[model samples]
Every structure is written in C-alpha cells, then in structure tokens.
Target: MTFENTLHFAQQLDRNDPLRSFRDRFLIPQAGGKELIYFCGNSLGLQPKAAREALDRELTVWQHLAVEGWFMRPDQAEDTPWLSIHKRCKDPLAQIVGALPSEVVPMNNLTVNMHLMLTSFYRPAGQRTKILTIGGDFPSDQYALETHIQARGMNPADVLVEIFPREGESAWRGEDICNAIDTHRDTLALVLMSGLHYYTGQVFDMAAIARKALQAGVPVGFDLAHAIGNIPLWLHDWQVDFAFWCSYKYLNSGPGGVSGVFIHQKHHNANLPRLAGWWGYDEDSRFAMTKGFVPMAGADGWQLSTPTVLAMAVHHAALQITAEAGMDALRRKSEQLTAYLEFVLRNSGYPLEIMTPADPAGRGCQLSLLVHQDGKRLFNRLVEQGIIGDWREPDCIRLAPTPLYNTFEEVWHVGQILLKFRT
Candidate 1:
C-alpha cells in the first residue's frame, strides 16, 4: 500500500476505491462554481443529497394531514405516525453506535442530553463525590460538569479530577488513565470522558478506560460527539454505562440535528433518578392523563420532551446513508485516507507537527497540525484557496478526510496547497 504524492496516483486510487460512489451521495460545497475540498466533517458533515427529499416528505405529511399527522397512519406499509417518528431512527442509530435498538434513542441536542444523563449517573454520596474527566475536553462538557457539581452544593475544584497528558505529549497514555482511575477510586462517583478527543483528534481507549472504572466500582460514560459515525464502537459489548453523541458531524445530519443516547439494558429497570417529562412516561398510559410519572424502559425513559420531527427527519436521512455504507467499510477507508494525508504532510517539507496519534487505531478521520508560526495565516490561506479545514486557538489546524464524501484526489490537492504555504 505505497502512496505516491502525485495527482495521477491519487486519481488511480479514487478509481479503485470501493466506497468512491459514496461521494456522489453528498452535496459538496462550491465556491465560485468550483467544488471546494471539504475536510471539515469532524465539525459538520456535507449534507446528503437525499436529505431534501426526506424532509419534503415530512413537510407534505404535515401539509395534508395537519394535526391528524400525529395519529393517522400514512399507509399500511410505512406506518410513520408523527407521534412515533423518532422510533424509526432507533435501529439505524443503534447500528451506528453498536447498541441494542431498545437501548438507543434519538432525542435532544448534545449538551442538554449530557445534563440529563449526568442527573442519573452523577449521584455524589459519602466519600465518592468527585467526577473524573480528562483535561482539554470540549468546553461545553467542562462547563456542564462544573455547573452540575455547583448546583449540588459542591465546589468544582473539590469534586473535579481532570487528567492531562504528561508534559510535551499531545495525547494521554491508556495506562496513565487507568492508573488515575485506580488512584482516585475511593472518591470518584463517575467517570466521564470523550470517546474521541475534540482538540487533538486522539481516540481514547474507551473500552480499557470503561473496564478500569467499572473495576473500581464506578460508572462510566462517554461524550461521543467526534467518535460516533467516524469510528466503530461496541457500546453494549464494551459494557459502557451510558453515552451520547450529536448527529451533525460524521453522522451527516444538518447543523444542530438531533442527538442520540445509549443506556445499557442493565439500568433499564433500576429506577435511577431522572428529569422526567410526559414523553418519557410509559407509552401505553402516556395519553391517559395519569397523575403518576411512570417512565418507559431503556433510553426512552430519559427523554425530557417530545421528539423534534423535522430535526429527526434530517437525522434519519443521514443515518440511512451511514447504514448503507456500513461502519466497518467506512472505518477502513478512513484509515487509508488519513494515512495518505499524513504521508503527504510529512513529505511536503512543512515545519508542522501532527498532533494526532500515528496509529490508525488511535484516531478517526481528523489530522491536527501544529504550525510552528503564523498558524492563523496558513489556515486563512487554505480557506482562500477553497481548502476548508478548521483552526483551533493557539496553533493547530484540523482537517478531516471524511470517507463518505471526501476523495483521494482532494487529499492530494490539500497537500499541494499546504506546500505552497511553506514557500
């Protein structure tokens, strides 16, 4: 599997790609009538071409049926009542996240779902009052943990234990993380970590970490925002206590699309504390106008409101695409595509450092570059050239060669553009 930094080579690779046809399923962005090399799927995936049609179908149902859309069966074959449209997403999303269909539910946005899950998992009592998480997590997660602890009358500094990579390293070692869990086993109430770190684009050893935490008598969870569709996961097999992810990124739902949650079957009937709503009540008695709050089983029990039909419509369109392509195939292409990008960058003679781990097992599609100087200028240059990648604060530029839409030729072109910056 030798890679040559030439357009001909890239073109040949694209021609040979089994998943190349997937690129046509998405509507790539254009600037001045030319398609831009879109490598930002880690942030927002390209819209699937089928999204509009799916959305239109939902809109038509609303137009013709009005209020009755909630109950009226559109057809015997389809059976898509608006009241339960969210249920259609469960199987597809379950496939993506490797959970039982009953264990996964497509619901609210990421941060909101995080708060809801925290309510159930982050119960501090006795000496076990601290929440363990990794440093440099997405800011929203940090804020959520801090505020939740404060709301419970605990100081963040006292209850939060954040682990960081040893000095000069960009990613945390698996052993270090496991040892930290052991070190703080006595006071830890919950272990919350990102499945794939947002900033450095490093894939944490989630299974190992989860095992360690569980062994220490702690419940573990993950924020899978960057991990969901971009990587393969076995949440149920991994025995993860809980997890949540947004759909807009590699899942290819539109911006602010619906999020998904996973709660293991072991906890389905535990009667854990939750912030309840009518939508979460047992389905059979939901419309009976009962006074008591009886939650549904599994992840549905965590729902706080009625599903957003339009957003779920968009999500369904995207998850359908993911289901068609399959996660194993997507992951295979991602490794090769990202490895090619790394080869191109290394050979480009730029004084840049790749922050992501070299091992394909330790990352998804993203490659973060630590530019020696003038990082912003270099990022702006790429943008000016219609090479869209993301830039994080100090000196890193993130590019994700999303397997579903991005091609080998585009990865090669990015290298050419990056070399231009070196001059």
Candidate 2:
C-alpha cells in the first residue's frame, strides 16, 4: 500500500482496492458532469443507487392499494408483507452492530430512541441520581441527558458530572472515564457517551466502560450514531444496557432514514418499566383488542407507533448492500485508508491539527482537522476544488472516506489538497 504524491499514486491505489467495485454501487453526484471527491460520509453518506428503486416499490404499492397495502402481503405464500416491513430490516441492522436479531429493532429516530431507553433504564433512586458523561459529547446527547434529569426532579448541575480531558490535552483517556465512574458511582445513575466521539472520531472503550459501570452498580448506554457501521461492535458481549444509532451515515440510508435500537438480552424479562405504546404490544394479539400491554419480549418491545415503512425501506435497501460486502471487510479497508491519510497529513506539516486519535483501535474512518487560521476559508477552498468535507463550528473540518465506497486514491489526493491549503 505504498503511496506517492502524484496523480498516478491515487490511480494506482484505486486500481489495487479490493472494495473499489463498491464506489460504482453508490450515486456520486457530479457538477457539470464531473464526479466530486466526496469525503463527508460522516455527515450524510452518498445515496445507494438502489435506494430510489426500493422507495419506488413502496410508492407503487401505496399508490395502487391505498390503505389496503398495510394488511396486504407482497408474497401471499411467504411472510413478505407491508406489516412485516420492520422485521425485514432487523437482521441486517443487527449484523452491522454485532447483536442478535431479537436484540435489535428499527424504531424512532436517534434522540427519540434515547429518551425511550432512558425511561426504561434510568431508574435513579437513593444516592444514584447523577449521570456521568464526557465533556465533548454531541450536543443532542447533552441535551437529552439534562432534560431527562430535569424531568426526574433533579438539578443538572449537581446530577451531571462532565469528565474532561487533562490540562493541555485534546481527548479524554479511557482511564479518566472509568475513574469518573468510580469517583461518583454512589450518585451516578447512568454512564453515557458516544461509542465514537462525533468530532474527534475517537472510539470509546465500550466493553470496559460497561463492565466498570455495571460492577459499580450503574447502567451504561451509548449513542452509536457515529460508530455503528464504521467499526466492529459487540454490543451483546459488551453488556451494553442499551444503544441507538441513525442509519444515514455509514449505513448509507438516505437522509432522515429510520433509526434502530439495541436492548441487551439480559434485560428482556426484567421488570424495568418503559414508556410503552400500542406498537410494542404482541403482534399476534395486537388487532384482537388485547386486555393488557404484553411487550413482545426483546427490543421490539420498545416500539411506539407502527414502524415508518418508507424510511425503513430505505434502510433495508442500504443494509442489503453492507450485508453483501460485510462489515469486517469494510473496516479492514477503513483502517488502511485512514492511516494513509494520517501519514500523508502528518508529513505535510499543515498547521491543521489532526485531532482524531492515531490508533486505528481508538478511531474510525473520519479525521477531524483543526485548522489554525482561516479554517472556514480553507473549507470553502476545498469545496471549490470538488472536495467535500463538513465543517464543525469554530474550527474543525471532518472528512470521512467511507470504505464501502471511498478509494485510497481519494484519501491521498485529499491529504495533498490540505497540504496545499496550508501554504
């Protein structure tokens, strides 16, 4: 995988990419008929070419059958039907996140799912009223945790413990997080953080953190919005109490596509109270006007309304592509691609700080660049050259070369462009 600074190096890397075939699998938008070098998949992934056709099938079914589509089966001889649409997508979702099919379910959007899981799991009582979290967590997570605390009649200032990086440091170490849990265990109700830091792309120690929190008599959950398809996760083995993720990023589902959830098998029969809805009731007797709410055993019990069929269809279409290519293979190429970028960027000596952790084990496909000056101008310049990356307010620009479709050649070229920006 030796790479050089010339256009030939990029073409050569593209030539050797085993997953290069996948680039054609997506819809790369072009301006004036030239393909843009897309590096923003961390925010919104490129559309799968099959997504439109999949959505059209449902549109056709709806247009022709109207309300009858809900009850009608697509294949009468088998189980394929509109009613089972959510069920159709669950298996592939589970595989992407490394959980059993029964342990995963397509449900509300990310924040909504977080709120639902909090209701069931955040049973704060006695001294366990504080929620321990990292300082640079995504804004949505911070808001959800605070709101949930306020709803429970607690002051967020006292109940929220924010673990921060050491003085003169940029990222929180795993030890610091565990120490925060240990120091505040008696008052910490939940230890929550992103499976991967949204800005820095630093992968957290979920397994170790979950074990530590559980040992300290606290529940641990994760917002996996950035990590689900970008890394190999063992949610079940890690004993994560619950987790949630949106599908539009590495999963390549279209914007506002349906999200998913995971509730570990250990909690299935536990009398943990939940904010339930009609959709969580047993499907077998749902239409029979059931007497009481009997939740459908596993993660499906967390559903509120009928699944969003159209959104789920988009996810189903995207997951099928990931399922075919396999997550492990995607991750393998991902490490190589990111490392190549890091290597080139570091050597270029750009004033931009490579804030993403260096170890492949501690991060994913994305790298957060902190440009020292004119960061916004530099971002605009990259865009002018057909390079697409997202700017996170203040100074950071995130570029994720998604392995399922992005090529190593693109990574090298983007790195060279960043170097050019510095001088």
lDDT of 1 by residue, 339-418 (tens): 99999999888889999999999999999999979999989999999999999989999999999999999999988987
Pairs clashing within candidate 2? none
Q: Give the alpha carbon lDDT tens digit for every residue of 78-148 in model 2.
A: 43567778888878888888899999998889999999988988888888788888986999999998899
Worst 10 residues of 2 by lDDT: 73-82
Residue ranges of candidate 2 with Cα displaced over 4 Å: 75-79
TM-scores of all predicted structures: 0.98, 0.96
- Name the lDDT value of residue 52 in candidate 2: 92
| Candidate 1, pairs of clashing residues | none
Note each model's CA RMSD in angstroms: 1.0, 1.6
lDDT of each: 0.92, 0.87
